[model samples]
Target: MNNKIGDFKLYLSHELGLADNTVMAYLNDINHFYDFFNNKNMQVKSTDIVNYMNKLKSDGYSIETILRRLSGLSAYFDFLIKERLIDKNPISFISKPKGWDKLPKFLNFDEVDKILSIFNTNDPLEYRNKILIEFLYSTGCRVSEILNIKVSDVDSKRGFVRVVGKGNKQRIVPLYNKLVEILPSYYNIRHTYFVKGRDTGYLFLSRNGNKLSRVMCFNILRDACERAGIRKKVSPHTIRHSFATHLLTNGADLRTIQILLGHSNISTTEIYTHITDNKTREILTQFHPRFRNRGKS
Candidate 1:
């Protein structure tokens, strides 16, 4: 079973082109299933698969986790069928789990303002951190994409920045006027840290002039959030989530947000609608004439 799982991993990587993390997740889920069936000494069937899912629920696994594991099993069964080890995919008959629509965590506009305001200082490092946070909110790029940005990626004249996203795909995201105004200061300070001979084109850099790692970016945002008295866990992704949510609340369409965020599918972009719906409900509850007149009627 372990050798068969290794082959599946290779197929996922070489044939499906899945990311490393995704491949590992699939493997891990399948390994769990394998362990559950190890002592059964019976042919795996749809009933067996259903029992496994029930076990997951009984063990207090989240709906999302159960759904993900089911998906992994589906793929694994398909591979087994292709290799003639299974006559049919047992997972095919199972209805997928539903109603796990948890929205992404995002900071509200005031919270974002508070975090950014904490860096209002003359320190160059503070300026860099401020620019990093601002840029994440402005462009909605993933932290990995942002870290890959070069000084040349900024088009100050045209007010846009080019971002290379997942699958090495590139897209242009518009920069707000505020980001444009701060660009010069960030650039000047960023260049001062450059080694005399090493010309790293990456926009954000470390103290030693190396490209900024994702962990470092998370630390920057976490520190800023702490200083701003925000108790929620904050990272570069929180800023990106805030970017999309704020845009949707301000009336940007889902398609436009999808394009800006470089999402391959609009379904991925629609999560922001949940946030917008909550905002709409808040507005209606607070100021709607019907709500205000309910006591009188």
Candidate 2:
């Protein structure tokens, strides 16, 4: 826990919306640099970074490994600059590793089923988790979006909920059949939560009755994944990713998914193609009008 690493971690998780694995990797890289000064001295200097990197190189780390570490360290410095904790990014001159981009991680239909089914509806918190996962996957919402939903925002009679997305933009997301079926039962249970605060009216509440935090959302999902025996680094984003990818795999078009995801640019939604390219190719071969007959005799 070097100086401000916790703050930097929060910045990465909440501000940047980084995946849990990426956030942990960045913090680990930054912590490694902090450990370089074995005396636990405070720092943010280019010279120390260079010397520590030199030590890593001398220790025979591969170029890919070195570049990845530097990328994370550079991101830390960039966060420091943004936070105004430092006026300059000490590692500003360094280049990030190329081709390091990863496709967003997603669970297939079966894995998603496992997580959804693992929670017993009899337990209140477990029931909440079940509803939480279903709601996220159904809406394809960001964690921030779903966490902000109030009871008033959902119109169960109409079968859709209003979502407030990035930049305070609001959109309506329909509840899928599975979630719609179980919601009334959840609402019955929800009425019994311990109200520790001023009754914030947020739909997702912690046992303590405060609106559930981003970290709590993460931990709940993580614990659920572990129970389901899913080894992939699962986060709330995984649900969102799975929702979009599964939709595409099942023939939902990118434009519709983009609007559902609240992405400002279709290019942002198009990234799901990287994850579902093979499936899409299958879909195209099976159903595309032009693919039905090519050079047929």
Candidate 3:
């Protein structure tokens, strides 16, 4: 079983071309499943897989986690079947967990304004942090994608940034004039952090001249939110959510948002529709003549 799992890992890495983190996550799920079945001395079967999912739910795992584990198990079983180790894929017929489409949390424009305005322009680090926040909101790029951006990726003349997304997929995200205006100032300050030979082409760098990490970006936003008196659990993704939500609110079509966000599927971009639906409800309740005075009835 252990050797089979090892082979699966290699397959995921070499054949499937999954990212390192995704591969590790799948491996972890498979190992946990194997441990549970091994301890029970039970042959892996459809019923056993169902019991495992039940166990996960009993242990208070989230719907998302359970579904992700099931997906991993399904993939693993498919591999096992292909290798003639397993007769059938037990998880093949399992349905996706319901209520997994909960709306993502996003900040309002007022809250975003508070966060962006909290930084003092005189302080270089704060100014840089401000730019980071603005950039996240302006382009709606993922944290990983933005952190991987190089200085050369930006086209100031054309007002776009080339972002490398998941699976090394590249997309061009347009930059707003507001973001374009602040970038030159940021580049001037960014150069001062360069060491003699340690400097890299990354757009955002730490004082040590290395590329800023994902955690560093998280902490920057967390601190900014704290300073801005926002109680919501804000991260870089919150800014991204706000970006899409606001665009939808302003009548940006779903297909256009999909392109901007680099989503290959329109369904992923359709999540913003829920937010827009709620906003529509609010507008109708406040201003629509038929909705007025309905509470009196």
Tell me how far the alpha carbon of residue 73 in candidate 1 is from the true structure, in angstroms, after superposition: 5.7
Tens digits of lDDT, candidate 2, 1-297 = 256688888888887776676788898887787777874446567777777777987898866577778889888777777777777777775444344455777999999999988998889999998888888999999998899899899988889999977646789999987788888888878877645548778888999888888899999899999999999988898899999999998889999999999998999899898888888678788898788776676
Question: What's model 1's overall lDDT?
Answer: 0.85
lDDT of 3 by residue, 168-253 (tens): 67899999998898788899888874433666888888777888888999999999999999999988888899999999999899
Error of 1 at 12 (Å): 4.9
Worst 10 residues of 3 by lDDT: 37-46
lDDT of 2: 0.83
Question: Would you list the rank order by TM-score, best first?
Answer: 3, 1, 2
TM-score of each: 0.79, 0.67, 0.87
> Could you give me the TM-score of model 1 versus the true structure?
0.79
Quote the lDDT for 125 in model 3.
81
Leading candidate by TM-score: 3
